[model samples]
Target: MDLLSIKDPSFLKKLSIKDLELLSKDIRKFLIENLSITGGHIGPNLGVVELTIALHRCFNSPKDKILWDVGHQSYVHKILTGRASHFSTLRKYKGLCGFPKRGESEHDVWETGHSSTSLSAAMGMAIARDLKKEKSFIVPVIGDGALTGGMALEALNHIGHEKKDMIVVLNDNEMSIAPNVGALHNVLGRLRTAGKYQWAKDELEMLLKRIPAVGGRVAATAERIKDSLKYLLVSGIFFEELGFTYLGPVDGHNLENLIENLNYAKKTEGPVLLHVITKKGKGYKPAESDKVGTWHGTGPYKIETGVIIKPENTAPAWSSLVSETVRRLAREDERIVAITPAMPVGSKLEGFASEFPDRMYDVGIAEQHAATVAAGLATQHMKPFLAIYSTFLQRAYDQVVHDICRQNLNVFIGIDRAGLVGADGETHQGVFDIAFLRHIPNIVLMMPKDENEGQHMVYTAIKYDDGPIAMRFPRGNGYGVPMDKELKEIPIGTWEILREGEDAAILTFGTTIPMAMEAASELEALGYSVRVINARFIKPLDEEMLTQLFEEKIPVLTIEEAVLHGGFGSSILEFAHSHQYFETVIDCLGIPDQFIEHGGVNELLCDIGLTSEKVVEKVLTLTREKQKRV
Candidate 1:
């Protein structure tokens, strides 16, 4: 059967278990082949093929809302919901989204990209369902890794206490980016061999009955310890204590078992939790053996031999550069420690973890907790490098504010992927860190012009001993520039002049520096003296240089690969006005006041008019506008 002919999950109700198994094989093949060309969360999607099929077959979607936590695993869900033909365009600009998008299909009841949101979203939907008196099942499928999140735990407490008629499917794959850490993961590991939940309870009762108490104080104490023993030995008792009707340790890849368990969950009341154990990369051999998270989400790879196809770039990745630099500094600086929110592989902190096992901490899937933990380490006068992606850092804003910034601790935050990360789309875009982190008091924000500057900035951030300094870096490889033999600490709050001019000024940082230079060069060839300045330090605003620009009365053009609102560009504007430089011609160019979609980085840059062509036009216009004003 043609997988492309799959219209909707409605057709699945008519299929037998064997037919569904065949369909799962087809779905896996479709994902492996298509994702090889397109590049996506193939491992996650492959893992959930049978589980998603079983879900769609068991529950009536659009009416019976099914929410996928962290959304990357929803590719299989999308295929089942009449999106099989759109596989070729997966994660491309204006094409099929990698994550569940509400606009794409009505079957996508909830949109997600970040983790641990499904439970809360499901509770909200369940509340709405009850208020309207609608008869429907609300199922939220969340990974075990996501369960470690504070928000998910909070939601779990509420959902259980409210006794909401919902089914929470805990997809325990034992890996989230890398292997999951924390006590919760251990609990699930023990639960894996503890047999069926009811059997564990009965077995515990049997053991309790045979304790051989000789009618003494020991017998009364033994009777009192019955409930405590269940918490210790019984399977799924952790969820049972949370007021959920615990079910499973069910095999997620098994269609028959999954369907049967899902049916049982539908019949049960008061928020049943079906703990389905799955393999991260179920079907493909290369992905199946992924001990690290290389296959979690990947670029285009060769299907036959499982070699990920990447362009030969001599330049080191931004993540590797920063993490390696930190590791280098950690050898000399005894106070330095590392923390990441379940992104050891993504952030390239494996080297750091290997070198200093005691100092490194991988706090799984809890960004807020990771931030606070960094803050906690800071209180002990320990230099904690809180490595996190820009998008995920948004989740820890309050912790950053209340704990890291408000307390004025020395936490060196290495902001990874600090620009428009192309393929992962809006939810994973690192564009808003400047906008969010800029306004916070007692905190310094900066981004590097290149990998060489990035390493120096990492050194600078570590040595500064200032109140919460963050260095933002882009996602991909650097410009492959010559590195200085010795590392140097750049003076805080100072901007670097890459090229000088008199007609106008182009001030930008990070990935946009080259664009600024290209625009400046074009303007110069056309007989315009455009100065290109790398405004690396986002905060403090290079006031001395701004004064010089104001005194010279040169038209200023600020560019960034970030949101325009409250971003670096906005900061430059605010400085000019506040310092009584009202006559100074200033223009800001960046990602417009909208969410950027998934595409190639260059394609996204062109789409948002962040290219050198756009920069040249902006500069020419600004200079012309200034000439008229003069």
Candidate 2:
């Protein structure tokens, strides 16, 4: 059958096991070919081909809800649910989303990008179903690695206590972006190798019955021996004790086994945890061998050779520059330590970890715990460098505010991907950090214009002893500018004048600085002198420069690659208002009050009018207003 022409998974129920196996091959071929061009969560999707097919065969979707935890592995589900035709435009702007989108298809009942949310969402859906007298199966396919999340554990406890009618599919691939850690992971490791427990339990029960009840003492002894068997044979007793009936260490790749277990789960009363073991990147050779999680998500690649297609001689990634700088400083400063919420590779902290194994901490997927851990480190006069993605940092907002900022601890937060992160879509965009963090007291938020400034900002953040300091950098490579022989710390709250002019001022920082400079140059050609200032420190407004601009009566245009509300630009506006400089004409350009979708960064910038063209237009408009006032 042609994969693209598939309208629904209803046909899957009619197909034989042999035909389903052939269909799985076709689906894998389709994904390997299409994702090689468009690029997506290839490893994850490949791993779930049979599992997804088995699920659709076992359940009636749209009626019986299937929620994918993290949703990166839902590409196979998408293909089966009439979305194979959209593969070419996967993760592109105004096209197919990388994650499950409720608006895209009726089959996609739950949307997810972050991990550990499916169990909680499933609980809510289960409650609603019971309240409405609805009869439908609720299955939440969560990964074993996601189970380590505090929220997932909390939901599990609640789910078991309530005994809601739901099937929790634990897709144990033994990885969540990177290798899973913690005691829960160890428990799963034992389960994975322990094989099926039901057979052993049955044999033990048969032997116990044969032993007979001779007397009260003998009966009690038999009962104790039977209970001890659970400790030895029942690998999933951990979940069983929590009120869920545990099934399998089932083979996820086996269609027959998956279908059988799923059907059993549907028939079972209360909650059931169907543990299905899968291999990440099961089909593709290169992805299957990926130990460091580079193939977890990727750009376009050569499918035959497994070679990633990237631009030649790209500048160092911002993450590497900042992380390496921290590593270098860590050598001199014994007090410095590195911490990440399972993002050592993404944050480029592998070097730091390797160099100072004792000092580096990979705190699994617990962002809240990581934040508080940094605060704890700071209280002991240890400089804790908490490296986290801006989007994930939102999960630890309370910790950042209460534990770190409130006590004014000396913590260095390396906010990676601190702007519009393309390809991962709306959920992974780092545009809200400025809006969320700028309001917190004793928290210094700053971004850098280039890799050189980024390195300096790292130095400044680590050197600053007053309070909690965060330096945000965008995703992808730097501009490849020439570096200085020595590193230096920039003064806090001081804006740098990249280009001096008399007529108007363009204030911006980080990735937006180049756009501002380009716009200023364009204005210069049209006989409009536009001054470009790098307002790097987002929290602390550059008061001296603001006073100068206001005194000169020069109109200001603030540009940021962040949300407009309460962002860097908002800080400038608030400064002008507080200082009583009411006549100063200020225009702002940034991400509008909407979530930006996955696409090329430049395309996203253009869509939101954060390009040089928009800056020129805004500068022209602002200058015209200044002329009118004059």
Candidate 3:
């Protein structure tokens, strides 16, 4: 079967279970092959092949409203819905999105890249469907790991209470990104292994009746015994207590089982939680064996060997450098503790976990709790390093402001992937951290130029006991700069002058520093003396340097890889205005007011006019405009 010929899921209703099984195999093979050339969430998609097939077949999509939580596992859904031909260009520049995009197809009703948002969205849809008096089955397929998120739990509570007509598929792969944590995961584990627990509960009740009760009152006190037995013998008593009709821990790979359960769930009233057990990386050997989430999302790989392709890399990855540095410092600093929200693998914190097992915490998918936990640790005089992706930290903004910033705690926040992450698109990009965090009171935000400076800044953040401080590091490898033998602390709120000039200045930091340097050289060749400054401290503007530049009346250009509005460039603009240096001709350049899509980092930068050529052009214009002012 040519998967590219698939137009929509309507044809699926005509197929038999055996045909669907064959289709699942074909889909798996297609994903494994296509994803080898163009990397994606292969492991997750493979796991959901049968499950997705059953979903589209059992319920009508675009009408019945099937929603994928996180949307990475929607590749099979995409294949069933006429996007297989675009798999070659998947995650490329102007290509098929890595996640569901509403603009791409009518089938993609909701666009999601972040996890644990599906249930809430599904609830909203369900409410709307009822308001309009429309009849449709609302199904939201959420993973077991995402079930641990506070938002997911809150949605479950609300959805269960509301008693909406929906099927909540709990896709239990036993892990999310990394191996799951929390008591909820343990509950799913028991449910996954023991499905006959309800039967055992009935037998236990019969046995309990035969036993003696206090004061021969079996009716009154035995109910308490039944309550205890609910936890012990009822596999899905958790969801049942939450007002949901619990279904089987069905084998997600079995097409017949999945279709049967889904069909039954659709007919059942209120909220039906269909617990489906599936393995992550179901068919592939290497991906299935990946316990550290290496195959969760990946770059290109060799299909025959199952080996991930890579360029020759001498530089350490930013996450590894930051986490390893934290691990190194943890050995000497007993008070230091590390924390992450379901991202130990991505943040490269395995070494830290191994060395300081007692001090390391992986709060499962709960970013809000992770932020406040660090604040709690800081109150007792313990240095806590909260390692979280910039995108995920957005979910915990209130905790950051209310708990961490308000108390003025010594919490060092290592904001991983703090720039335009290319393939994951707008949802995963870390561009908004500076804009979001800089305005918060008593919070210091900064980005380092290279790996060496990053380590020093990490040291600076850990040692600085003033208030909450955060260091931003990009997604991929560093610039391979030589690290210092002894770690040192950079002065707080100070900027580094990379090159000095009189005509014009380029103020930038982190990943954009090299581009600024390149532009400076280009301007110099054209006879314009361009100054380059590493304006690393985003919150605290280099006021002394700004004052000097303003007094000299040098035209300036602010370059950032972040959003221009309310970003580092805006900070510089606010400084010029507040200080009343309105004469300083400042030009801001960065990601314009729009969502950047999936593409190569360089491609995205070029499209957004953040390249060196743009830099040179902007600087030349600023210099020429300044001369005209004179």
Model 1 residue pairs with clashes: none
lDDT of 1 by residue, 360-441 (tens): 9999999999999999999999999999999999999999999999999999999998898998898989999899999999
- In model 1, state the lDDT of residue 152: 97
Clash count for each candidate, listed in order shown: 0, 0, 0
lDDT per residue (tens digit) for residues 406-498 in model 2: 999999999999999998989999999999999999999899898988888999998999999999999999999988768898999888899
Worst 10 residues of 3 by lDDT: 196-205
**Tens digits of per-residue lDDT for model 3, 1-630:** 889899999999999988988998899899999999999999998999999999889888899888889689989989999999999999999999989999998889888888899999999999999999999988899998898988899999999999998899999998899999999999888788767443355567777667765435665677687678767766558898998877778898999888877877777889989899999998999999989899999989998888999888999999999999988888899999999999999999999999889999999999999999999999999999999999999999999999999999989999999889999998988888888898999999999999999999999988999999999999999988888989999998899899989898889999999899998998899998888999999878778988988898899899888888889989888888988998889999888888888899999998888899989998888878888888
TM-score of each: 0.95, 0.96, 0.95
lDDT per model vs. reference: 0.90, 0.90, 0.90
Which parts of model 3 have CA positions greater than 4 angstroms off?
A: 196-233
